[model samples]
Every structure is written in C-alpha cells, then in structure tokens.
Target: MRFTDLISYQALLEPSKPAIVAGGKIVTFGMLEHAVRSLSGRIHALGLQPGSLVGLSIEVPSRHVALSLALARCGLVSVPYASAATLSQLPPLALGLSDGGLVVGSAAINLVVTDEWFAPSEQPVPDVAIADDADCRVFMSSGTTGTPKPIFQSFGGMDAQAQVVANHHLLAGRVSRILCAMPLKSAWGYRSTIAALANGIAVYFAAGTADIPMTLAAYGCEYLICSVYQLQELVRLQSETMIPLPSLAAVCTGGSLVPAELVRSAQSLLCSRIILIYGSSEVGHSALEVAGMHPWQDGATGFVTPWTEMEAIAEDGRVLPRGETGELRVRSFAQARFGGQPAPDGELPWFYPGDRGSISPDGRLTISGRTVDILNIGGTKLSSERIEHALKRHPMVIDAGVMGVADRQGLTEVRAAVTVRGAVAEAELRSFVATSFPVAAPQMIKIVAAIPRGDTGKILREELRALLN
Candidate 1:
C-alpha cells in the first residue's frame, strides 16, 4: 500500500484522534486529511505531473507532515530539503541529486508557494493513482563529507520500512503519544514520525533542543525519538533539575555510537528503557539493543534485526566466522536509492555499509568503527571508536572524538578532542584515557567547547582535523 493511503485509512478508522501536535496546536486525523487534500488540490492545479520532483523547505512540523503526505498522494516525489539552508545552496544540491523539477516553500526560490496556496479550499481533491514501485520520496544525506546526496525510496519500500520501525520500537498500539527531537528533514526523524502516524499514534514536535524535556512533559508523551547527542543533553538537564517525565516509557537513540555511560546515566535519571539503534540512511535499522536485556560491551550494537541479513567480511573478501572483527555488510529488501537508483555501486548482491564490526554466534552485532576512521599508528591499526569510548568513560567528559594526525615526519599519532561538562586538565584527561586503554592511548588531547558533528551526530573528522592545523 502507498504511504499516503495509510493516512486516509487512519482518518477513516479514527477521524477524531489526534494526529499531530505542533506549535501548541493539535491537529486531529480528520483535520490532517482535509489539509492534505486541500494542499494537494492546489499542487495539482499547478500542472505538476506524476514522478515530478517537488522540493519542500518548510520548518513547521505540522505543515511539513501534511505537505509530504499531499505530495505522495498526488504521485509526486517529495524531497524535503534542509530548512536552514539558503536558496542558493539548495538549487545546486537539488539539481545534482534529484530531478529538480520544482521548489515549494516560504523562501524566495523558484516555483515558490505562498501562504494562500495552502489556504483551505472548497474544491474536491482528486485521487491520483500511484504505482507501488514508483518513487515517492527523496531524502537528503547528512552531508558530512561534502554535498548532501538525494536518497530515493518507493512507496512500497517506505511503507514496509515504516512498519518495521514501528514494530521494532513498540510504537504500534502501546505508544499513544511521541515527541520527535531531531530535525524533521533527517531520515530518522521523518521515518519515525511517519511510522508513529501510520500506527495511529500522535506525534509532538519540539520547538527546539532546549525545549524537548518540557515538550515531552507538557504533551505527556510516552516515547521519544532523539539522537544520541540529544539524549545526552536531556540526561544532563534532568540530572541538574531533576525534571520528571511522568509518561515517558521508552527513549530510542541512534545516528551514532551511544556511550554506555550515557545510556546508564539516562536510564537511571529518566527511569526509562534506553534502546540503542545502529543503522544508516542506506539501511533502515540493522541492529537494536535494549537496556538491561543485554550486556553493553565495546562496539556492541545488540541483536541484528530480523528483516536484514548482516555479515562480517575479512580483507580478502572472505566471510569471517563469528567473533572475528571485519567490515560489516548488509542485505535488505528495503535498501535506499541514490539518484533514483539502487546504491552501493556495481552488481554486488550485498551493500557494504563501510562499518567495521563483528557478529556473535548468538546473533549480536558489534560495530567497531567506520572503515575510513581507523587509524594506523606506526603500522599498528587501532579503531577510533575504541579510543573515543575510552575518553567518554571519564566522568568530566561529555563527548569525545579521536582521529589520526600526521606530524612533520609523516608519522601518524592519535589526537583527541573532547567536550567536557566542567574544567578538567588535559594531562588528567589524557592520563585517564591511558589508564583505561593503555594500548591505544592518545598522544595529545584538546578540550574544546564542542565536537563538530553532522546533523545525525556523526563526527566530522575533517572539521576536527582542521582544529589541529
């Protein structure tokens, strides 16, 4: 079934049920259907055809959600661009990644739409038939390396992925209300919000990061979808003020490696189960870990999800046996599209995620680090994830990033940058890391205000390297 059809079905089943809560206004399913239909009629009047690429730069969560569903119902591929990006920055990125047929938003861009376009209309919205395999949405990558690339997915794939995420997070019938703390344009944010909506759950969008805890408490949300960094901030806030989220039961965190210490601290203060998810934009979710259900070990990502096939391969292209570390590869029925086409280059059956990891005989997946982030010091290879994990163990450290830097002699040494909650001596921090992991101690450590990160919380290694220069 098309993802848009799910909204109509929900409206039919529970029209009066709350579908979205944004900007202190509640929109019921009935109102959502009407708004989508009204906006869709306006879009159709513009003469845009099926499969046409429509760019969306709306910042309001309610409007973004409605317009996305409307674009899908009209059989148009909706590409949600970064709301904070400039018009000049968007066109080139959209042209290189998507078909770039039209742009729609409050910005003064080409084919711009005004407030009147989304005003309530009396015209009946026509039902546009859409093929199951037709591309329905284009999501931009986090753009950590360079320009963000457009990732496409079919209607059927999106529906299937939404179901998988909903089922995995227990959002179907158990969760009545959820708060999304990430940007609506992010893959995780968009997918998790739609998944909740598809399962007949109400979603609350926070005004900003600082307001997440208050939003959750005000809305009495039962679940929260946030990045690891956001979770860390929430934990810090809760610890300082002892704020109570009376209804919050589960907190799902992903987009980067979550420190075990952070998870333990959050679980203690919030009294909520911490679910760590490991996956990428290319693959929806490959592994999941629930607090107290499994032992949190270095690089452990918990059990692999049932929908995807995961394996570890050695340098010689040989699939390694369980308990051995190697490059992680995944094969799933719901793979993402690049430039409106399937990704991973070549005709290989499996998609290499470029993550170094290992799978246990019991089926638990442990992600060691990214292939590109591995550091070679005097021919001794070390995983950057391990060093970062060690640095994070310090009580004063809030976040840490480790990378290789070459010196005058072209010899690589491990350098670390960290964000701390309080004043801490660099020598003391380095000494702590050395004691924690003597074999992989960093040669130098710099205390910074914050580590540069992408939207999804992945460290920008190039940006961190620039600090050293």
Candidate 2:
C-alpha cells in the first residue's frame, strides 16, 4: 500500500460516511473524495512531479485532510511543517529536500526573495511522486540538544505504523468521529487521519484549546486522541460544566511518555477505557496496551505484532530479569531509526526510547520512568516516576509531576505539581504527599485545574519548572 489508500478504499465502500467536521463544516467521505480528485487534478497542473516531496503549513481543516489524502492518492510524499519554523529555515529545508515547494499560507516570506519558492501557492501544496523506499516525511526533534535533527520516516514503515495505532488504540473501531490538535504531522496526525478514514469515521479539529468540547459537540464527535495532559484538562472541564460530552469510546494520548494518572482521570470523565500508546515518528511500536474490555490490565505489553519484540534492559547492557527495572528497548517490524543509527539487516534493530520500566514474572511489561529521568537526591538514587506513582495513590491528586532541581551545592530537592480533584487544599495535599513516600517526599504540592501536558500526555517538565520558579 502506498499509504494514500487509507481513505480511498473506504470512500469506495462507505462514501456517505462522515470524514471531517471542522467548525460547522462537515465533509462526508464522498464529498472529501470529490475534493481530493479535483485538488489532485489541480496539483498535477502545477508541474510538481508525481512522488515528489511537498510541505504543508496550515491549520487543521477538511481541506487539510483532503489535500493529504489526495497527495496519497496521487502518490506524493508529504511533510506537514509546524507553524513555528522561521523564514530563515525555509530555504535550507527547500534546498535539502530538493523538492521545489512553497509555503502554503505565509505571505511575508513568500513575497520576499527566496530560492525555495519555485512558484508559490496560496492554496495547499500539490501532489508529487514518492518511492516505496523513498523518505515520506521528515520529523524534527524538539531541539532539546541545541538544534533538532530532522528524522525521516519511510512511506512503507508509516503504513505499518498506522495499523499499529489502529489495532493498539482501537481505531480499528466503530466510532462516529476522531479528534486531535494536528500537533504532530507524523503518525499522530497522519496515521490518526488514516486510521479513522480507513475505518470510515469522521475526524474533527478544534481551532483552539478553549473550544475543544464545543468542537466535539459541534462535530458530533465520540472518539478522542490526545496527550495525557489534554485528557486531564478535559476531565477538569467536564467536572465543572456537568454537561454530557460527545459519547466517547476510546482515548489514546501519544507524543510523550503519558502518565497513568492522566489515563485514570480521563477514564472516569470520558467513561471510556484509556490506553497508553507508546511510539515515535522513528518507529510506531515501542509498545502499546492490549485492546478489548480489559485494555488497561496492569501487565499487558502493548499489542505486539509478529514484526517486533520489546525489551527492558539495564544500564549494564543486559536484558533485565523479569520483575526488574531497566531501559525499555525495541526491535522494529520495519527498518527505522534505532538509537540514532541506521538499521542493518538481520541485526534486530534496537533503540532505547528513554523509558525506564520493569518486566513482570508473567511476561508483562510495566514502565517505571524515563531512562534519562534519574537523579541522586541526597545520595539516594531515585527515579521521579517512583515518587509520582506513590503520590498519585491519594484520591485528591489526579495527576502529578516530580523533578529534582539541584542548586549550587549539588543538593537536589524533589518538586511535585499536582492536578487535583477539582479544588483541594494545598497544605493538606503536601502533607498527604509527604506521608506517601519516604525516599523522596515532596517538599511542595501545588494544585491546579490540570497539569500542563505537551502534545502527548507527558507532563511538560519545563513548564512545571517554570511554575516553581
């Protein structure tokens, strides 16, 4: 499959199915297909070769979905860039991709002299050809290490990943709608779009955070995919509004190491099972929760396919015995970026996804913390996840994030920020946390409506750091 066939196949079978609802606009599968066919014709007229790489920088809309599916139908490789990129970044991206493309919605830089703009399009970028082995899209890292590395994923691998997300999160489901912020351009958005389209469901997008529920009600959405943090926020809102939301089925929050508290709260609020989906643009299956009525059963090591195996290995480079904590690693179903290195055949490609976890005696896996999320608090080594897990046992604390901020003398104190159950006293919550874990008791606990989460439900550590300062 060339990846574009996701919605195309469904359009033939269930053309009347709703495909997208943005604002008040609703696009049926039949209508979206027509738009794609027409836009593809316009795309070909633009002289961009079929299978060529093109970029899109636009807000989420029916047209965004139409153009992407059209490109897939037309066999063009697409990379949807974040709006955060600077004018200085475009020309280099253009030169490196070597695909003559233009900014879809920008006027200032497009009008100014630039080698990147072959011929500008105020409309979406057109379709071009992409090879089976060719790079389909490039994912830039968060620039945590100064500048982010642009990671390229293959079209074939991404197709398999779509299957993973669908099966793992129940997108191979019967639902009326799917929702996201279009936060990540890769599987989070692309595969999500494909999964829903493949299953003949509608996808809805809220213009901003304030309108999430309004967007759902407006679109008649029933299924949602968000970062863990987004789910917590939703729960906080639901607790307040006391309004019945669009009937939800399943929720999958990716793009970071999602917290169980986020899952627990959303499960209660949405009245649906919350499955933690672990994946990245490089490879989709690090692991995932099993589907079915018992999806969140404590020990399921994500729905595994015949293509890969999951491992928990210690710092000593040995796969840990069951019931021990170590770094989580994976072998891919397809060739992918393994620990920042290229895969070689028959080698069983592996990469540490920065999660710290333990394998159970029953052969199930449990994630404990991030491999990099370790610190020495007064010479006692502690993983932030341990304190968090213990702290969340309290009913009042809905979600919690712990960080060991070390000062000048190398003394590190653990700081905990909590998304509480509606409104709870701050001092009492701190005392509750202090009484939970003796190893790294929280010196402080701040309650908010919800914790700050990035695209994926992982607590934004930097944002929490700012809260204390």
Candidate 3:
C-alpha cells in the first residue's frame, strides 16, 4: 500500500492524533485527510489530469507536505525543489505550487483555496486507479558534480521505502515525534515525513537552524533527523550553553562522514547517541553506524542492512571479494538508476553510488571516498577521504578537503585545503600526513576560510578545487 493508504488507515483508527506540528499548530490525522482531499479537488478543478506533473516550491513545510499528499492522492506526480527560483521555469501545465497559488512563469493561476484547503469539499476528486508500478515522484540528486539529475520513483518503490523506514528498530515505541531539520525538498526529509505520518508519528519541521532546540523542548521530541554538519553545530551550541535535552534519545545523521572526534564530542556534551547512516537518493539506506554500539573507525559507515545488498567491484566490472577496496554498488527495492534507463539484457542493475570502498567478512562497509574524488598520484590511486581524515587528525585542523593537481611535467600530485581552528604552518600540516602516505604526501597545503559543501554535507570537490585554484 502507498503512504496515503496508511494515512487513511491512521485517520480511521486515530483521527485526533496529531500528524503534523508546525509553528505551534497541530494538524490531526482527520484534519490532514480532509485537507488532502480538498486540495486534490482544487487541483483537479484546474483542468489538470491525473498523471500530470506538478512542481512544489512552497516555503511552508506543512503546506508542502499537504500538497504533496494531495498530488499523490489524485494520481499526479510531484517534483519538489529546494529553491523557489526553480519554480519559474517549469513546463506548461506543470505549474509550481507556492504558498499563494499555482506559479507558471512569473504568473499566478490563482486557484485559490478557502481556509487553506482544509475545509471538507463536495467537489469530486478524480477517482483514478493507481497501479503499483506507476510513476509517482521525481527526486533530484544532490548535484555535487554539476546539474542535478532527475530520478524517477514508482509507487511500489515508495511503498517499499516507507515500509522499511516504519519498521526500523530505531524508530520503534515511544518515538512518537521527531524534529526533521532537513528541508522537505530533500529526499530524506520528504520520505521520512511521509513514513512517519503513515505510521502515526508526529513530525515537527524546524523553521530554521536556530529553531531546533526550542521546537524539540516544546514538543518533547525523542528523535532528531539531521545532517552531520548540523549535529556538529548542535553539539558546539550545547557545549557553550551546557543545556540538557532530557527528551532527546538519539540523532540520526547522514549525507557525510561523521568524524570520530565529533561523535565523542556529541556524546559528552549532548547526552545523545549519534546514528550515522550511509545511503543515497537512488537507494534508501545501505548501512548505518550507531554510536555507543559500534567501535569508531576512520571511514567506517557500518554494517549492511538486511533489506539491501552491498558489494565492491573492480574497474573491469568483476565483483571484488571482501576486504578488497573497489567501487561500491548497492541493490535495494527502492533503488533507481541515474537517468531512468533500464538495465541492458533485462538484468537487475546494481546502482553504483560512485563510492570507492570495501565490505568486510562480517558485512561492514567502509567508504574511502567518491570514485571521482580519487587522487591519481603518479598512477597510484589514493582516496581523498583517507587523506582528509588524516589531515583532520591534527589538533588545529577543523576540516579538510584534498584534490589532485597536475604539475609542470603533467604528473599529478596531492594538494589540500583546510579550515583550522587556530594558526597552523603549512609545512607542519604537510608533515602530519607524511607518515600516512610517505610517497604521495600533499605537495601543497592551503588554509581556507571554509570548505564548500552541499546541503547534505557532501564536500563539493569542484567548488573546493576552484577555491584552491
């Protein structure tokens, strides 16, 4: 069943239960259901047919969620974007849903909704039959490389992902509310919010980074969903104030590597465990590292989940054995290819997440770095993640990004850019990594104000290279 089906079930069982809490307002399951139906009718009245594509750029999280469900309920595909400016160029009839009305190329359709589309509507929504394999959503990639790629997802795939999320042990019992700090436009945020609502959990969307603490305390939220950077910032904030969050049980983080030092700082200061998940927009979740339960390793992501398949492969496409580092591939029911292309020969395609790493005999996964980010130093490949982690081990270094630059002889050499907490000599930092690489130590080190990062905390290699240049 789809997430909307689950919501309908929850509405019947517990109509009064709060499904969404935002800006001090609560929308119960019953209210949510009515709003979805009313909004569906409102959209259908616009002459938009079932299976039409719609873009959502609403700034309000609650409105975004409601409109998304409305789209799904009436068999329309929704493409949600983080930037409101993106809404200006959508295809005809594929209008962007804003807080005010439908936006089409700087013009508003004025499909106005009374009472914010919460009132019950006698207007009939299209009774379109939805097939499991029908296209439902288009998720945009993080775009660290360049332009974001559109990944199409089917209803069955979404259902599988939602079920996987709802049944995960970490979200079980008494974990009724969560503060989703990530924007709903992100795959993580939208999927998690829908999954929570389907399973009768309340979702609180933080207005901004500054609103996290107040919302968590006010709602007594037991769980927090955020990125690795946000967790670090929160830990720093808690360290300064020494305030306690008695309700917080854990922080689920992903989108980037969680440093061992940062994890320790969080434990000591925040009184909460950090759960580092490894996944992509194409694949839901591959592995997870839970603080306090697993030993800290430099690039350890964690063990593979039961629902997913993980393996390493060589350049020739042969699957590598455990302990042999190579490109990483993942297989899951929720996975989609880069461009909606089906695998050749009708074979089940394994999604190459562009990560270079290996799995141990016990099924643990360690991500070394992005496949594209690998440094070709004199024909010997090196993982930038490994180099960056080594540089970060220095006391003064706060963060680091490594790249390969060509010299006068056209030979590639290692180079690094770092953000430090205090003064550090370039030679001193170079010496720090000499012991680890000896042969391919960074020939040049540059101090930078900050490293460029995407929304989810992935280092923007292209941007970092530009900064270093």
Judging by TM-score against the true structure, name the best candidate. Answer: 1
lDDT of model 2 at residue 442?
A: 69
Instruction: List TM-scores for all candidates, in order.
Output: 0.89, 0.77, 0.88
lDDT scores of the candidates, listed in order? 0.77, 0.61, 0.77
> How would the candidate models be sorted by TM-score, starting from the highest?
1, 3, 2
- Model 3 misplaced regions, further than 4 Å: 82-93, 100-116, 169-173, 340-346, 377-381, 386-400, 413-450
Candidate 3 structure quality by residue, lDDT tens digits, 1-469: 6788898789889999988898888988888888888888877777766667777657666677888888888888887754434433344335556555544343234333346566777789667788887777777777777556677677888888888766552532369898888778777887888888888888987776567877888888888888876776677567667666788887788776667787888778755567778888888878886766766666788789998988899999899999999989887877754453256775557787888888999888888778887888767787877788788778788778888877889888788999998988998888889888876678889899888877666677778888776
Select the stronger candidate by TM-score from 1 and 3.
1
Per-residue alpha-carbon lDDT of candidate 2 for residues 1-469, written as tens digits (9 for 90 to 100)? 6546666777788888777877777788887777777666655555554546556654546756666665565555555654445323433332112123444443222212122222333455444556665666555544321233455567676677667656654642567677765464544666677666766767787766557777766655667777645665677777677566756666666544445555666666765666656665556656566234444543244544456666677777888787787887776765454245355875756766677777666545666556556767777766776677666667777778887877777788777887765667766666665675565776667665666654435565667777755
Rate residue 391 of model 1 by lDDT: 84
